[model samples]
Target: MSRLSLFAPDNFPLIQPGQPLLPAIVDALTQGGQPLADNDILVLAQKIVSKSENRFIDLGDIVATDEARDYAARCLKEPRFIQAVLNESAAVVRCVPNVFIVQHKLGFTLANAGIDQSNIDPSCINEEHRELALLLPQDPDASAAALRRQIRDTLGVNVGVVISDSFGRPWRLGTTGVCIGCAGVEPIRDQRGQKDLYGRTLQVTMPAIGDEMAAAACLLMGEASEGRPIAVLRGLEVIEADLPATALLRAGNEDLFR
Candidate 1:
C-alpha cells in the first residue's frame, strides 16, 4: 500500500524582491522542524514567485492608450489596470462590462491577465501606488528550474517545484488551483493503450498530475488571509521528468474554445 502526505512548514516572514528564496525556505523548514526530504514536491503560490521577481507594477506609472481607455470604459475597469492586463495578455479572449478575460502571455486563459491587487502589503499601498498589481513570473518554468537547482545546490536534495495560481473555468462556479509552472516532475501521465478492468484498451487517457498536486496544495493555501504559501507533497512515486507545465496546456489547434 502506498501513502501520500502533504503539509506546510512554519510560515516565513515577508519576502521581498530579489530575495534568495531557496535559502529562506531551507531555513524555515529547519526552524519548523520539518526538513526537506528527497523526492518531496514543493508547491508554491504564484504570488510569491512573482513578488520575488519584482513583478509589481504601479498603476500610476501607466498611461492608458486610446484603445486601452476604450476597452476600460467598456469593461468599467480602471484604464491603467486594463492597460496592464493588455500588456500581459497574448490576446484578449473576452471583454465586457465588469468582466474581462484574456489568454495570458504564458498561454493560460485567465481573467485580467492574472494581475492581482489583493493581499498586498500596505507599504506599497500609499496614495502614490494605490493600485499596485503583481504580474505573474515572466518565465515560471525557468523560475521553477532555478529554484530546483538552488535547492539541490543548497541541500543536495532532489525535489519537484510547482508554481500554482487560482483560476476560474468555464461552467465552474469558483476558482481552483492550477499549475502555471513546474520543474522536476511529470506534468502528465499518459495511459493510452493501458488495459482497464474490463480488459478494454484505453485509447485516450492522460492525467494531469502536476495540476492535481497544485490543487491539493491549494487546499492548505487558502485564497484569502492564509499565510501559508507553500506545501510539501511526499510519497508520490512520480518519475523525474523535464516536462514543464506548458506540456499540460491544450494546444491552440486542439482547443475547441478558441
Candidate 2:
C-alpha cells in the first residue's frame, strides 16, 4: 500500500539567519517518529532556503531610482523593495497599474521574482531593524545539493530534496509551489510509449512529480503560517541514483509554447 503524509511543524520558532534548516527538520521528524522512509521526498519551501542563504532585503536602506520610483508608484509596492526587485529582474515582461511581471535572471517568469512582504515582521521598520523580504537564491540547484549532502551526512539516510517556490501558472488564477531545485529524485517520468488500460498508445505523457510534491507541501506550509516550512512525502518510486530538476525544463527549441 502507498501512502502520503504531510508533516507541519507545531508552533516552531522563527528561523534566524545562518541557522541550519536540515537540523531543525531532523529534530522535528525525530519528534514525529522519523516519518521519512527510503525513497521519500522532502518538499521544502524556498522561503526558508532563502532565509538560510541570507537572501533577505531591508527596505529602509534602499535608494529608489527614477525608474524604480515610477515602478513603485505603479505597482503600489514599497519603493525600496520595488527597486531591489527591479535590480534582481532580468527584464520587465508585463506591467499594469498594480501588477508587474518580470523575467528573472534564472529564466523564471514570475511576479516581482517572488519577493514577498506578507509574512515579515512589521514592527521592525527602523533603520537598524528594517523589514525583511526574501530574494530568490542565486543558485537554487547548489542550495539543494548542499542540503542533500548535509542530510545524508547527518541522518545517514538517503532521500530526495526539493527546493520550491510559489509561482503563478500561465493563464491560471492562483499560485502554487513549483520545483526550482531538486536532488536524488526524478523530476519527471516519461511514459510516451506506454499503453493505457484501453490498449491505446500513449503519447507525450510526462508527470512533473517534483512540482506536484512541492504544491502538495505548500498546501500545509501555508504562506502565512508560522513554522512548518518543510513537509515529507513518502512512497514515491525511485528510478535514478542522482536526479536533478533541470531535467523537467524543456529546451527552448523543443517547447511548443516557445
Candidate 3:
C-alpha cells in the first residue's frame, strides 16, 4: 500500500440495542459526505457492537459462587462483578488487589474478562440496576462477518471490518487497541519463508495485521468520550478470506511468559 488514512465521521446518534448498525453507519458516512470506497476498512469499537447485540448484564441478577466471592475479596472488588468475570473467563490467569486478569472464554488474556461500564447511556440502564456491565459479543468473528455482508448489501462495496477493543499488556505501561473480531482481512501475515533484503532466509516473522489496523484506527477513536466509535481506514490491503481474530491468540503451548 502506498499510503494509509484513517478518519472518523463526526456525526452519529447514540447507538441502541437491536438497531441496524450498518444502515446507521451508511447514513453517517453519507451525512458526513464520506461514502464508502473499495478496499476501505471499517474499524468499530467493541463497546458499540456489544451494545447493539444486547450483551448486557445486571449485577443484581448474579449469584456469586464461593470461588467468585473469594476472588472478589482478594481482588478488593465487588462479588457481583467478580462473578461476571468468572462467568466470562475460561481460566484465571492473574490476580492482585484491584487487578484481576483471566483468559477470556474466547482465548484472549483480558483484564476483568473485558467487562466494561463506561460510555453507556444512563437512560438505557434500569434505575435499580446500578451495576450494569457490558460484555463482549458472544462471537466477534461472526459479528464482523455479518456486518461485512450487511455493508456489502447496503452499499455494494466489499469492504473489511474490524471490531477493536483496548487491552493492556503484561509489561506495557499503556493500553492499545486490538482486534477481537475481523472479516475480509488477513489477521496474521505469515512470512516465514520469505527472503530479506540481503536475500537471507527469514524465520518466524508473522505480523498481526488486524491488530495493527485496529491500533491505527484507535488513534482517531480515543479511550475517553470521543463520540467516534467507527473509523474508516483507507488504502489498506484486504484479502478475501475468512481470517478471524482467533488467529491472533497464542497457543497455550507457545506461551512462554505463562
Candidate 4:
C-alpha cells in the first residue's frame, strides 16, 4: 500500500489582484515548514490565480446586448452579468433561473463560464467595479506551466502544479473541484490493456488523476470561507509528467454526450 501526505498552510495569505503568487506560496510553505520537495504536487485554487492575474470584471464596463438581455430575463440574472458571461463564453449551453451554463472560452462547459461572483475581494468592489465578477485565467494551462517553471527556476525543485475550479456535473446536486489547468502532472492514467487481478484485460480504464487531486485539494480549500487556497500533495506515483489538464477533456470524436 502507498501513502500520500497532504499539507496546507493555515495562514496562507489572502490574495489580491496583481499579487505575485509564487512569493505568497513560498511564504506559506516557509511558515508551514514544508519546503519544496521533489515530485510534490501543488494544488491551487483557480480563484487565487485569477486574483493574481487581475482577472476581475467591472460590471459597469459591460454592455448587454439583445441576446444577453434575453438570457438574463429568462435566468433572472443581471443583464451586465449575463453579458459578461456571454463575453467569456464561446456558446450558451443552457439558461435557466439561477443557472446559466455555457462553454467557456477555454473550452470548459460550466455555469457562467466559470465566472464567480462569490469570494471576490470586497476591497475591489467599489463604485468603479460594481458587483465584481472574477473570471478564469485567460490561459489556465499556460498559467500552470509558468508557475511550474517559476518553482523550478526559483527553488531548484521540480513539482507538479494543478489549478482547480469548482464544477457542477450533470445529474449531480453540488459542485466538486476539477482541474482546469495543470503542468508537470499526468492528467490521465490510461489503464487500457492492463491486466486486472483476475488476469482480465481492461479496455477503457482511464482515470483523471489531475481532477482527482484537485477534488482532494478542494476538501481543504472549501467552497465557502475555508481560506486554504493552496495545498501540497506528496507521494503521488506519477507527479512528474509533462501533461496538461486539457488532456482530460474528451474530443469531439470521443464525446458521447455531445
Give the runs in model 2 whose Cα sits over 4 Å from its true position. 122-127, 241-243, 250-258
Give candidate 2's error at residue 37 in angstroms: 3.4
lDDT of each: 0.88, 0.77, 0.90, 0.89
C-alpha lDDT of residue 204 in model 4: 88
- Best-matching candidate per TM-score: 3
List candidate 4 stretches off by more than 4 Å: 125-127
Candidate closest to the true structure, highest lDDT: 3
Write the residue-wise lDDT of candidate 3 on 18-62 in tens digits.
Answer: 676887888888888888888999999999999899898888899
Q: What pairs collide in candidate 2?
A: none
1-258 per-residue lDDT for model 1 (tens digits): 889989886566667766667777887778888889999999989988988888888888999999899999999999989999999998988899998999998899999999998877747445556667899999999999999998898789999999999999888789988889999999899999999999999988999998899999999888787778888899999789999899988888899866
- lDDT by residue for model 2 over 11-77, one digit each (tens)? 5556666678877787778787765566778888787787777777776667899998888888787
Cα RMSD (Å) per model?
Answer: 1.6, 2.5, 1.2, 1.4
Could you tell me the TM-score of candidate 1? 0.95
Better of 1 and 3 by TM-score: 3
Which ten-residue region of model 3 has the weakest summed lDDT? 121-130
Candidate with more favorable, higher TM-score: 1 or 4: 4
